[model samples]
Target: MTVQDIRSFNRFYTHLIGALDHGRHLYAPYTLTESRVLYELAHAPRTDVADLRTQLHLDAGYLTRILDKFERDGLVERGPSERDPRRRRIRLTPRGRETAELLDERARQAVGTLLAGVAPEDRPRLAEALRTVRALLSGGRVPRPEDVVLRAPAPGDLGWIVQRNAALYAAEYGWNAEYEALVARIVADYAQDHDPRRERVWIAELDGRPVGCVMCVRDTAPGAARLRLLLVEPDARGLGIGDRLVAAVVAFAREAGCREVVLWTNDVLAAARRIYRRHGFTPVAEKPHRSFGKDLVGQDWRLDLRAASE
Candidate 1:
């Protein structure tokens, strides 16, 4: 892309941001930069002033002025750093935390409304594209391992699992509604009849948004857990999220006293297959099939917790 192209995008994005952040940074009294400082502090409770300035890449003098204003308004407090007596530490007051929470809620709602205008099938593609832009423009900074979180599925997550699986497959692979139906059935079964001890679903979150997911449900056969619906967002791929999800399933399966873990997947999903192989899953069976609006070869993979099984 040319410089003019980049500039054009910047202009468009600036107006889009201005509209999204109406009422002075999502209806708060603070300016955009001040709201950003609060947001950083809200995520990282107490931080050194120098570190904060570096993280935001703001001019030292300007940041100091913002901090001064914040302190005068009683939103933040400055103190000698406990870690280093030579430096200053910044902490938000209780009121400041409340304001930060409000900002977060408002930002979520604003983004939700923006997304509501988009077709449901296109959100994943749009989300991935946005992340790609950030990653590229940020000098390809690698996200830390801690940035990806794996937690038990919360309300609405099961539905998300089905929807994302359906939308992503249909968009990327030209799969049909039958695929979505299958995902819906699988998720509904888990939702209606799942034992906490023997079955679990994990949602992978990045930047507080769901980006990937997997599940381990009790297979019809005894002594085996079935791994299902392993997926990582396209832009989130290099962060090893897919591997992490599979690893979680293995850990849970072993802890649940399952002799082995198994999964069914198509040959086209090479990335997921690689992760499974890395975790010692071997293809146990394969067959040609006509399904999901495609001619495909489906494979059954097994990971034996028993030493010999591996």
Candidate 2:
């Protein structure tokens, strides 16, 4: 799963970057690796052909060729190291710095353009995900489930909640447009009429994208809260997001002084059922029903938070 996920992301990222002028550094007549070399020279405290070759894992001969090109273009100056005359140190020329700056701006704008549609609220997730990718690729420490962030719905997150849930259910369960409409309606209602004290939504983010979500809303029964719309992305499953989301809802219910928390789900949703059971919810009722283009048994479960909290 890890390998497939990484490969999928690679394909997506490659396509995304390629759309930015085939992944070449825009506004610079340099290939990606060439630009990287310039970036290191511009930023690194000490840079030499040997260090660049080792750090970048480029062949020594190949790195020397790149340096030769940079020197010819007046983008770099090389001289014998002060500490070891046998070794050569490299530095960016003024023109090289100018080129690097241009490359930097182009890169920044390119990323900004890609994320322009992203809600300002979710930018932190994107940053975190980038760090995770770097760490994973570099064979560094990987974050645990507790490292996953649960945040409030940012702009566009509500829409995402509806879209992803609908899409996932449709693909996985053979449900149809009716389910999508239901999700859209639920989101619309929440958006229009949620009470701050009694209603809340949490979006579980992994690597800057919404992987799961849940809502705790005022139940029709007085002093009760309804746990609604719990979902976890397929890739993010087994990471405890569903468990975390349910836990968040239950905790909030207790904090808000709700006497009980309730939820309704189909029996076919085995994983979710297990999560709810672990959190002390007991099945209160079950009935056969036709919904979302399927004939299924719907179960209502409730958690007596007052009892559980004590």
Clash counts for all predictions? 0, 2
Report the CA-based lDDT of candidate 2 relative to the real structure.
0.82
Backbone clash total for model 2 is 2
Please list the residue runs of candidate 1 whose C-alpha ends up more than 4 Å from where it truly belongs after superposition: 1-142, 308-310
Q: Measured by TM-score, how close is model 2 to the native structure?
A: 0.58
Q: C-alpha displacement of 219 in model 2, angstroms?
A: 0.8
In model 2, the Cα lDDT at residue 236 comes to 80
Per-candidate TM equals 0.56, 0.58
Q: Write the per-residue lDDT of candidate 2 for residues 231-262, one digit (tens) a residue.
A: 99887887778887887787667767899999
Model 1: per-residue lDDT, tens digit, 179-278? 9999999999999999977898888887657999999999988999999999888878888788878877886677678999999999998888999999
Clashing pairs in 1: none
